[model samples]
Target chain A: MTTPPLAETILSFLKKINPHQPLPTAEQNLFELALLSSSDFITLIQLLEEESGILLDFTQIDPAALASMQGLLAAFSAAETGSKL
Target chain B: MDHYPWLSPPDHTAQALRMDHHLWHYGQLMTHAELLSRAIDWSIAGPLRLLAILGNQDPWVYPAMLAAHRLGGGFLPLHPAFPSERLQHMLHQCQTRLLLVTSDGLATLDQLLPNLSDSMLCIITEDTKGNRPLLFPQHRFLDSTDLQQLPARPAHPAPNTQAAYVMFTSGSTGRAKGVAVSFANLHAYVRYWQTHHPIGPGDRVAQPADITFDLSIHPIFVSWASGALLCPIPPATRFAPARFILEQQLTVWVSVPSVAMMMERLNILRPALFPTIRLSLFCGEPLPTRTAEAWRQSTPQGRLLNLYGPTEATVAISAFEWQAESAQQEPPGNVPIGWTFPEQQAALLQEDGSLLLSAGTGDLCLAGSQVTGGYLADPDKSAAHYFYHPDSGATLWYRTGDWVQRREDGCLLFLNRVDQQIKRHGYRIELHEIEHVLRARVGHDWVAVIPWPGGTQPVRALVACVAAEENSPTADWLQHCRQHLPSYMVPSRIMVVPQLPLNHNGKINRAALQQLVQATLFPTEAT
Candidate 1:
């Protein structure tokens, strides 16, 4: 079985958290739309780690990286590729 | 001995405080305060209070507080993170003429220049070069360099009846209400602490609260009066509170329960992590049983205390010493608020204005030395909450708005706020009770219960926002709640979030949670 893309996994998790609200596009601002809080950001990181098999240190990651869907995908991609964020 | 205990001579050498790398001795604090007081007298012509917008744990803040008191003027401490509009409102509310700002607060003041009055005076503590232009040309600017050159004067005493400080609390009316605490009230609180929980020389008290919060008053005044060292935790280290306590070897730990919740979230609360802390206190919000247990394990040698009070009450007017065995005997969510202070009287009043002596739930009313005079310059607001007690020789009682049940043992167990009580299906439900049940089941201390479809609806759903560890399923939490709570009391929806939102005061922001529930669960409804 093939794995889903990073953006797909993030969008899926966002939908699970708030099924009533419209799902955000990859470039949409999750934080600005009130779809994410500090706690929700932590949960998103955990979900991304599970889906991508990349362990990210919550303390080391900048909170700005979780502000938007694009930022979330970038953070996940950086962790997966072992590159600096 | 000076009438003001804070200005009196220390019992030992002046090593009174340590803020990170900086060490402030008693003599240095008094000398700087004297110099700052003289500068204020020279620069400002009229009677005015000095409002400080500095870091809570800044070394200059304590002296600024003393200087203001010495000049017979009140000191208002404001959080720098507050929006310029709110800051402007506070400045206007207090009629602040002189503002004491640290070099860090200069940028914030610059942004607020448009909102500040032209007659305002700015005193910058770290501006030695004196290069920064005044935010307003009419605004007078003084720097630390100028204050050091001013000749020191003898300590001028403020009247005991004078207002010591003015703190702004968010009012239910969407505006900030200024609470003016008098010197007599503070003195009474200090005397109460001295008589009950006495701190002596060599004690290191932790200052973890924001300078604007009333919780900060406990460590600041108690440490200064006892000649003990006030160790202020830096903002960067606040998240890792257990590590900060261990590194500082803080003898007395005083902070909101949120710090412990954060420590628990980060898995930092190891057994015996804070062995040096002799007195551990949690206040500003409800103390969950699990958080209390984790804290007790960390500070095995320390005495765990839960204090209760609003800003209207000076610091904390009541306290409960948590005992391990007794805590286990009580219900899972119940943490007794314990006994009122010696000078204060606590009563539970029913809806019909009759007092409930024992074994009943009602509004908790407090009357005594710890209560403030009233809200700043707003008698209407003050009259709404405070009233004269005809039975107690006309003593004013502050209606706390907190609904608490007086147990037969004379201890008070806090229920939800009277405002938070929702009537659904012809049944009145306390939202905090549902939150308590959820917290007990989820093993998480950070949980909030807000009314869903929130408005003037007679029947509303209860939405439970639980801060769970990663990968925890919401269905299991819902099942757990169903098992524990009755049909009417169980929450309609159990939402699993990573953390609960906090407002400026560090308490659970119910308004923000209600907004989140509305946006996510009821998006079609008007917020």
Candidate 2:
């Protein structure tokens, strides 16, 4: 699947926080992101929630989006489009 | 009738007491209590106004316990081996009018007497006929002859919130914090434990922890509250754990991981030795997976429970039941402290002042009735850690410096301390994640990931390991890690150390390890 525009923005924000991780693929899940202990996840979530005005619940959000770099970007795109899916 | 009602109440007679032998027998205990009641009455009325219980070895402390309870005087329990200063501080703090000691502890107490106030009385447990300045009357274990002469006193209710005992806690701050646990809290704890772990009349609880440590309160008071047998082990014999448990037929083990590890290392527990143990309780420090695995292999009949709490919160605030099947699969990185007991709540909060409720990870905080009011003397430090939740109203939550994540499954997994979070260059780092990842790869099951101060560069990861040289290849370990972790997360240098310095409780002494690293970096030059 093509990287979603929302995913691109989220990935950019995450990369800004963690220079070591330059690019993120949508397949990366919550466990992987947590393993990296990246600074961007929380900051990006807040930024997206503020921009979209839809207060995202990171705690209950789909584990797949936070699973890998690819998955996180995809989730960000979905959030931007106003669908939790 | 005994003169002191609260001190020597008739209701505290042999009928109310319960003692059990491991072989499911009970005659000797009843007979002994009857005899000891009289002996304590006689001794107290006669020359022996004071008594000292060595506490560690004397299997039957019931009579001594009753004797102190009946006499309307306080029972001052001390670790027979405590350094003079610590012991003196405790004795002074407790305002102990009299001190009871066994023959063995006499020498230690005697050496400390000059430093002690002259008003104190010293009573020995074993018979020593002497008119020496420090010498006093000795009392024997309960025998049939003693019970006959004891006068029965009227019963009165025990004050629930009165100071039952003062136990010293080692605080991160320099001064030791004395947790003055109330009788009400003790009673509540005992009632709570008794309800959970049903103890009938004949059950034997192995009291292994030193009296100085609060965990020992479980075996001491729980036995009394539930009418179970309290079996004390010799302090020295604690080193030889296997023999002690086997001979004592210890039904419950209440101790820290350090003592438990000693038993595991010494091969003290075999399949045959522990059929009676219903519960093996571990607390005070973290239990390494290796030690937990060893215990599981030895005891299949009993349940192993890990209890976690600061002394500030009475003995244990949270507990996790260790299952052999589940543990073998995940093999705990840092065992989650489970959840708060009955009425307690555990929460996490983010740096932005938002509460990270429901599976969110941040600074782990505890709120409940079990949370103590504050530190004994220091209000500034106390105010910093304890805060009231205006949203919750009236109730306060203690800001435990521990950082943790509430897992999706609702288990609270402990991360490192909040202070452990350090920024290397612009990157925030948690050293524990690196340590956990390193152990997952290497043959060295033991590893500590520490950041070395690097001038004008990102802090260097100084990895210390105890990997075996014969079979495990270092390249394979690095390659295995490369597949899972990013290059930045990996340690800059992985060095093999002969042994890691461990604290008294067997945890890798992080402060000492950092000091060792600093020493290596700046070695002393000989003149």
Q: What is the TM-score of each candidate against the true structure?
A: 0.73, 0.57
Task: Indicate the TM-score of model 1.
Answer: 0.73
Q: For candidate 2, write residues B393-447 as lDDT tens digits.
A: 7877778777777878777766556664433321234566556556766645577
| Worst lDDT 10-window in candidate 1 chain B | B42-51
**Displacement of the residue B317 alpha carbon in candidate 1, Å:** 0.8
Interface RMSD of each: 8.3, 19.7
Candidate 1: residue B452 Cα off by (Å): 10
Chain A: TM-score in each model: 0.76, 0.52
Instruction: Tell me the spans in candidate 1 whose CA falls farther than 4 Å from its real position.
Output: A1-85, B1-4, B7-14, B42-51, B54-57, B129-135, B420-527
Top candidate, metric lDDT: 1
Query: What would the per-residue lDDT of candidate 1 be over residues B1-527, giving only the tens digit for each residue?
Result: 32244733355365788986888788778766776676665234223354455545467888888888766766888666665666777777776667788756766777876666546667778846254464367677778787777676666566767678878765544356788788888989989888888877778999875677778888988888888899987654453455456666789998777567655654567788778888988877677787788888888889999998887888788888887785668777646788888989888887788766677899999988889878876788899888876566777889888888888888888876777655443233557666766777778679888876555322345778888766676666765665544444566566767788998999999888888888877675453
- Which predicted model would earn the best DockQ? 1
Fnat, model by model in order, equals: 0.00, 0.00
